[model samples]
Target: MFNYTMKDNCLAKKVILVTGAGSGIGRQAALTYAKLGATVILLGKTVQKLEQVYDEIIANGGAEPAIVPLDLKGATQQNYIDMSSTIAQQFGHLDGALLNASMLGELTPYTHIHQQIWDDTIKVNVTAQHLLSQALIPTMLKADNASLVFTSSGVGSKGRAYWGAYSVSKFATEGLMQVIADEYDESNLRVNAINPGATATAMRATAYPAEDQSTLATPEDIMPLYVYLMSDDSQNTTGQVIKAQ
Candidate 1:
């Protein structure tokens, strides 16, 4: 696991956005950020799940959270722009953004990968991320130090059999992260990617149903890297693919 001791209220007064904030790693990260004193914006397709996280944050004595219901597959560039505008209007600046939403298309052989699955996977994991980053960069730069963290995978840099569009999309994600990081180098906004390794999440279960959940790390177990990247501890770090295990 990545080692970083987070102090209480490390993220005080910060405004962060988390995609896929409804469940699994995203949900845990949102709660953790809020607990550390950041106001989180939960963006996900499911409103009910967002509300549940919102309630949990409020009940835990964290800052009040905002929710943005969005399905990345069908979301347009304009949607992201408008959302960024709203964030600028409401919060004046964005301290961080965790682009964690991803779609795992069927694990079929390369030749057997369905067209629809490929399209949807790329749309959500690649295109949506591109648009969102473009829109959020301006708002993020408004802060003194802003971190843009993109979720990656073990296979993002190393290709594996049967991973299909999910793998390809992750490769694109890594590329996107590198591009943004290089562009914003020495600037207020820093960009990086994190590969959350073999966590016991619903997505992990879907990818490997027969795997023993008891042996895997929980979402909370891998949060040190998440908190480190978002907090001022890693203000000088950028353009790296960090593994959380």
Candidate 2:
């Protein structure tokens, strides 16, 4: 540990937006950020679930949070732009954005890839991330330093049989992070990706029900990496794939 005493709140004055904030890694990231003293923006598809995170943050005496219910698979460019505009108007700048929302298409043979599923997976896992970042870059640039963290997968770096669209989408995510990192190399923004390995999340459960959940790390257990990426301590790092295992 970095040994800052954690303070129950260390992210003072930072404003972060976490996608898929309703559950799993996204929800845990939101809570971690808030508990560290950040004003977090919760973006997810389910209102009730987001409200749950919101309530938890407030109950913990952390900074209050905001909720944005959005479905990335179906989100339009205009919607993201409007969201960006709204965020700018309210917070003026964004210190960080965690692109954690994703869709896991049905596992199938590459030859049997369903067209609709492929498209939806790409939309949610790739296009939506780009659009959301596009909408927020201006706001992010306003900050003295800003971080953009993309959620990636192990299959993204190396192809795996039966992973289908999910793997392809994650590869695109890794590529996207590098592109942003290069583009903002001279700017105040930094971009990177994280691969949370074998996490005890619902997604993991769906993908590997036969595995022992007790053997894996919970979302909270992996938060140190998330916190490091979102905080000033990581201002010097970018364009790399960091693992939380």
What's the lDDT for all of these models?
Answer: 0.96, 0.91
**Which pairs, if any, clash in model 1?**
none
Candidate 1 local lDDT, residue 81: 99
lDDT of 1 by residue, 175-229 (tens): 9999999999979999999999999999999999999999999999999999999
What's the TM-score of every candidate structure? 0.99, 0.97
Top TM-score hit: 1
Q: Which candidate comes out best when scored by lDDT?
A: 1
**Candidate 1 lDDT score relative to the true structure:** 0.96
Error of 2 at 73 (Å): 1.2
